[model samples]
Target chain A: MVRSGPYDLNVHCIPESGDTIEEVVAVARRLGYSGIAITNPDSMKQLPFSGNVEGFDILSGVEIRADNASKLHGIVGKYRNKVDIIAVSGGSESINRAAVENPGVDLLVNLNIAQDSGFNHVLAKEASENRVAISFDLGDLIHLKGGSRVQAVTNCRKNLLLIRKYNVPYVLTSNARSCFDMRAPRELAALAALFGMSGEEAMAGLTTIPHSIIARSRPPAGYISEGVQLVYNEADTGNIDEGDR
Target chain B: MKLLPPTLRARTRYLAFEVISQDPVRREDLIRELFSSAGSLLGDVGASECAIRLLAFEGSTGVIRCAHDRTDRTRAVLASISTVKGTRVIIHVLGISGTVRGATIKYLAGVDVFNPKDSHI
Candidate 1:
């Protein structure tokens, strides 16, 4: 049996605004989120609070927008360690350069603009070359659908195939503007289903992949302690009775 | 101006207006015109027209309030003002009470409230 893992991934954290770092941590805890990507534009400084939440982990990251491929290439090459996830804010050229230059950073590819610039092919190529993971945004997924939810699902399925084919890493995240807009785990799973994801695949998008990204972004001390060991044991033995513990 | 609808009992009403005239000064002129127009409506009812007051200009939207009794007149004045300058008007009538005020105060106390016109409620 193919084992699907937990979902752990998120994007965006605007700390410069009045929003407190604690509030962001609280929201992640309430939602059963395992990972969070702290993304403010060009701001790579550690958040005022520790990235480690009470129950979840945080990945320090940023979403940067460059004017062109060359500029993006320069930024990624220069500050790869400064960010955990390098999301190209917009522009296909920037994304392409990011994929090529900072091969380690997880690429949160916006499918809407990427497809327009024929960057998806290059994105897929780079993912394979660098062993870097990728995730297509639902906003772009929605935009590509052009108001038709069904079409959006079909497009997402095709996009997933490309990810699988290229062996690019992938995850799921709601591009929420406010705390009220964040989705619960079950809701995110349901959304993934619309993209032709199986229950296990959907679960992984929300859990394991996100966890992996967070792990790579920030290596927290004692992260693989007893709790994580217990989880691993449960996965191995199919005795998830203590999974919630 | 008509009377407040029974549905809007005990509600605080906010009047919103947009500038339509191409002239740069016309927008400010229209705002002044609206204040005067509101005064006239209150005068017709024999109520204290002085109570009808301009509160503040919230971005492109304006806020005016009186005791809830003149809601209809407020709406009418806003509509008439729209007609005079060919600008569009949006009237947001909200039911404000202890519960609403508490929620508003709690949510707004720390946050910088961007007067987005639509979020007044």
Candidate 2:
């Protein structure tokens, strides 16, 4: 049987949160997750960066939470090549726009304010064109209660519609800070259903999109850009001056 | 009291789950939390449609009976629950089966279902 193992694109460990990476990974494995990315902001120094923990994949991601557009752009530039994933913490309108417009940013995480959805058709178009994935952080649904939870669901539903209409890539994340906050992939899919996402779409978000994002960010050495790479032919390997032999 | 014929009876699914908590949680508190979470998320009428019931709970693992078609909805209810009796908890669904026995055998392995002491009733 072929199983598309699920990957959580957003998780916190160590310096960013109280729980250690090993503890979070152990709980995630018990829940049947294939891997998890530790997206701790400004704490990349503490991560192994490129290796998996005991065969389970561990991606070193950075979550950039800045106050304004300039600062957000500056941080994105610095971390663009340093991390496997770049997620912008969405809150204000300008920050949302800046995130989607920059191809360097992989995910615009949690796109909502108190009442505003913090997203629109323009941002959706930009996200689609830039290939920036929109993140539906289900952690809000887990952490928020009563009226706030209802509000978060409503906003997510609205964002889902826009994402579908624009054909933008969207990712599902528990946004877990600890083992208690983490959930199995199936449970995450169920919570996504509460916000109008179909089972298939949820699965793609959990597996396919995240995998593609990781692959896209980290290319083989001598990589230039998309559809462009440095290739060396055997004949071209020898210097022209020495070809006289 | 007459029992409904097998052909006319409602189809049900058994979901086996495990409770990972900060503190040891009793069966009663877990049941209470399940109902409230389902009720609040799915509403009263929706909860009734799912026909969710706690069939058996032993230690941290348990089996819940729900409508066959509502398994996903029941999963959402379980996922929505973040706490039980003020203690932080996560109820992760182990697996689902058409029959309670199948669920127990497949997901609740190592637990003696027939043992009275293991029954949290």
Candidate 3:
């Protein structure tokens, strides 16, 4: 069985319009979260993090939202190194295309909000290659109802089918602006079920997917690419300073 | 008229949920919103068949009853609500069980707001 207490990757925090980082942590723990990424604006990314808050993992993140593609490229290039998670807001078809095509974008949120999912077979293939995750912002489902909500969910269903078929990474987030906006993990799973995901699949979207994203974000140790880190015993490799001299 | 046979009666589900808001939520407003959301989402015929009933509301906690087949739709309606009486609010579903006793005793038993010692918070 998948473990509960899913992670939220798109919470607005600190110096912005959302809840303070401390308040978010306090309320998230009470709501039974395993970990959370406080994805504030890029300006807040430079602010230091306190390792872990109350034993819950708190990852610092940045979200880039510009109407034009060049600005998005510039912002992602600057903040990709600075934050643990990088999310690009998806609204226009162009923004969606730019976000998934760029290698630096860790997540693309709001893909299906304004129109379609902003991804066709070609775009879906590129996103899969780049490992850019697509997030279903629960706030959309919460705030929009009637026909608009129906349209959003229908679009999400279409997106989900393509995501699964093409092997694109995907996640679920509340995009919570306040402590009160967070939902219980169980509730989120139920909502995902309505969008054509199984309960286990929903749990994976909440838990495993985010966990793996964080894992991928970590820099490889020993300063080497895949399958190529050199090692030597301390006794054998000692006196490197003297050897250089 | 005699009551319908046990097997003929609708199998119901109890949904335990919590309301996170700055102000106390009145029962009338909660009822109105439930029907309003159900109606808007599922339309008149679907909402009419939902058979929603507000079982209880204690502070931030509540238990709602709906038909077995309509539980998923009812949960979506619960998720769709973001406000009550102009105050912004979020409704979190705790769990769903077949009986009221199961919903309250198993799910809502330790959900008391006053008891900080309760671990389920």
Cα RMSD to the true fold for all candidates: 15.4, 5.0, 4.1
Candidate 1, residues B4-112, lDDT tens digits: the string is 8969755454433222222222446555766655544334453353244555444333445555554444443443332334433222222222333442444223433
lDDT on C-alpha atoms for all candidate structures: 0.50, 0.84, 0.78
Residues A122-224, candidate 1: write the lDDT tens digits: 6677766875656645533322323353444555677677776776667776554433334445445545654566667766666676666556655665466
Candidate number achieving the greatest TM-score relative to the actual structure: 2
Q: Over the stretch A141-186, how does candidate 2's per-residue lDDT look in tens digits?
A: 8778788889999999999999999999999999988777888999
lDDT of 3 at A172: 85
By DockQ, the better pick of 1 and 2 is 2
Candidate 2: where is the Cα deviation over 4 Å? A1-4, A43-48, A221-224, A234-245, B110-121
Q: Give the candidates in order of lDDT, highest first.
A: 2, 3, 1
Name the better of 1 and 3 by lDDT: 3
Q: Return the interface RMSD of the candidates, in order shown, one decimal each.
A: 17.0, 8.1, 4.9
Question: Which digits, one per residue and each the tens of the lDDT, describe model 3 over residues A1-245?
Answer: 11245898888766775456676776677677877887766645455562564468878788787788878999999887777899998888788889988988999987666766676777788899999998977777777766788888888888888888998988888888776667667667667777888878878888888887887676555555656677755688875665654
Task: Give candidate 3's whole-model lDDT.
Answer: 0.78
TM-score of 1: 0.51
User: A-chain TM-score per prediction?
Assistant: 0.70, 0.90, 0.88
Off by over 4 Å in 3: A1-4, A43-46, A219-224, A230-245, B114-121
Model 3 C-alpha lDDT per residue in residues B2-120, reported as the tens digit of each score? 99999999889999887867677898898898888777767888787878888999788889999998786787778767788787677777888999889888788777452111223
- Name the fnat for model 2: 0.51
